[model samples]
Target: MKKLFFLPILFLLFACNGNAQKKSSDKAEEKFEVTKTEQEWKEELTEAEFQVLRKAATERPYSSELNDITEAGVFVCAACGNELYRSEHKFDSGTGWPSFDRAIEGGVAYGSDSKLGYQRNEVHCARCGGHLGHVFDDGPRETTGKRHCINGVAMDFIPDDTK
Candidate 1:
């Protein structure tokens, strides 16, 4: 009887083992269109941008001015100027990050991230393979129902010149 109780616990433990998690470096192994050496990237991007874009590190929430941006324009990758999210899709998620309902098609790539000890859909710039952010299912249901929670330091806002 005691063995039956331990069986479920053992199963849960094995299910959550580190081996089952996807390695974060898996995305790094893939080639991107705009490839640059670490030195080159370091020179072009600021410290905060390099850490988030190159190292896949998360920035402190609410630290980015992009979160409050409501103007019309597009957000592009800070590393390579790759077009990412359009202004029309941007929304306030109240999650302390710039949230968008969708990304420009073919502009971003998806990968599995288990760095948090759980599965998350990681977003990256397709042009440069720079880490952008994560996508979650919980978002505005009126639209795509996906929240692209991106790091502000990883992007730059280009306001519409016609406006």
Candidate 2:
């Protein structure tokens, strides 16, 4: 009957609503040291930077200028200048993005990212909560064995001994 059809639709709607509420609460629990309005972020970042950092959009593979960087430095968050990773931890993951074996202490935070259907670890700046990239397990076993695959556009490198 019509009642049976409505029951399944109602259940589906209720389940989806519950999931959305949980996700929103999960985000609320994460408090960043730096907060800004959407306009503020847009004004400060370039178009590509805004798209990746604020909107969590991934840049095209191999499109980042920082992918080939080999200098000694620290990578800072493009939005708030928070030091997120050290040059020593960076490696070539061959995924066309800058890959780091580990993040600097207290610089980045890891969260569950279910955007791609299955859950993955998402790396973001702890200061401003700007999207940096995701982490995966297929990294060099000699080190942490965790690959912190990051967006080059989301970072600004400040070399050691900048003098």
Candidate 3:
């Protein structure tokens, strides 16, 4: 009886340890590994892109150039040109900013953003760590309840040329 109990306990410990290590590795990978300086990002991004991607600025609602864009294409990071969102996932959130129910797989990530003391998830470009915007739980129920509220300056819409 003692041997059986010890075996299960040992198994449980190993399982938990494995889970912890896996979570750590996943976190490390979720974070962008780029080491570009601010000046480098600034030089690479336009003035508006720098404001949104580097300073975490928010563009006014309903003011995005891509808000009305309906052509099928990929939306890429304006700062680093990283593919972030698919045009198919883009949707109207009635919040003014460009909203998406999902992102290209592994193209973006969320981190704790406390700049406003509200503990929101700060969205970033997975390829470059450039700030995109905050994500909210209030989204269309037809898909993920996560709304990727992106600043227009952080993304460039590419219309599909296949048409």
Top candidate when judged by lDDT against the true structure: 1
Point out where model 3 deviates above 4 Å: 1-34
Compose the digit string of candidate 2's lDDT tens values, residues 1-163. 9999999999998888665345621444788889989999899899999999988899999999889889999999999999999998999999999999999999998777677667778888988988899999998999999999999999999989892
Candidate models: Cα lDDT each: 0.92, 0.88, 0.80
In terms of lDDT, the poorest run of 10 residues in model 3 is 19-28
What would the C-alpha RMSD of candidate 3 be, to one decimal place? Answer: 8.3
Worst 10 residues of 1 by lDDT: 17-26
Colliding residue pairs in candidate 1: none
Candidate 3: what lDDT? 0.80
Clashes of 2: 0
Top-TM-score structure, candidate number = 2
Q: Write the per-residue lDDT of candidate 1 for residues 1-163, one digit (tens) a residue.
A: 9999999999998889767554665676888999999999999999999999999999999999999899899999999999999999999999999999999999999997887778789999999999999999999999999999999999999999843
Candidate achieving higher lDDT, 2 or 3: 2
lDDT of 2 at 19: 51
What TM-score fits each model? 0.85, 0.87, 0.76
Candidate 1: C-alpha RMSD to true structure equals 5.5
